[model samples]
Target: MIQKETTGMILRKLRGDRTQEEIAAILGITKSSWAMYERDERVPRDEVKIRIANFFGKTVQELFYTPIEHYKCS
Candidate 1:
């Protein structure tokens, strides 16, 4: 089935080699918050989403709504 990529996956990919603390500081968020976001344990508010998207130079839709297909073997 096809599923949208989770925000955490997108964040982690965009973050690359950057430290979570560094990204959190740049985005004006706590490292713990960023960690949670990366773990898919929390969702950021719309404003924070916008900030993250802007920091990554991607639109919210591109970052949060992209779809990926994952097939399971029977």
Candidate 2:
């Protein structure tokens, strides 16, 4: 699993004003899956990762490599 800090940043971006359940619905994933992602307990599949990156208007590389701050600037 990746670091919680990374997952936390991803979670914060996905959350917006929605609950985790809401975000999970938007992503077509189970609430438990979303929780696991947030907790850094599991790594999402490539397709799920792509969906998340697309939701945030980010490239996969940005999501996987760049820090949140760097992503914000691009």
Candidate 3:
């Protein structure tokens, strides 16, 4: 099966050479918060998800496809 790319991979590709602070500015969020999302230390809130998708000109699905815990394959 084809594996979906993690949010970090998509973000890294979309952000190109931009720094974390620059991306945070685009999303109107703190750099640490953006870093947390990239590091998978925390999930982004719904509003933040929208901001991320919009900033990168991607649909949320294209940017994030991680299965929730309940949906993980056994």
TM-score of each: 0.79, 0.70, 0.77
Model 3: lowest-lDDT 10 consecutive positions: 63-72
Residue-level lDDT of model 1, residues 28-58, one tens digit each, is 9999999999999998888999999999899
User: Residue 7: error of model 2 in Å?
Assistant: 2.9
Q: Pull out the clashing pairs in model 2.
A: none
Over 1-74, each residue of candidate 3 has an lDDT whose tens digit, in order, gives 76767888778778789999999997899999988888777888888898899877888877777665456688
lDDT of each: 0.90, 0.78, 0.83
What range of 10 consecutive residues in model 1 has the weakest lDDT sum? 61-70
Give the clash total for candidate 3. 0
What are the per-residue Cα lDDT tens digits for candidate 2 across 1-74? Answer: 46444765776676788888887898999999988887778878999989988888888776665554444555
Model 1, position 59, has a per-residue lDDT of 94
Stretches of model 2 off by over 4 angstroms after superposition: 1-5, 66-74
**Whole-model lDDT, candidate 1?**
0.90
Q: Candidate 1 regions off by >4 Å?
A: 1-4, 66-74
Task: Report how far off residue 32 is in candidate 1 (Å).
Answer: 0.6
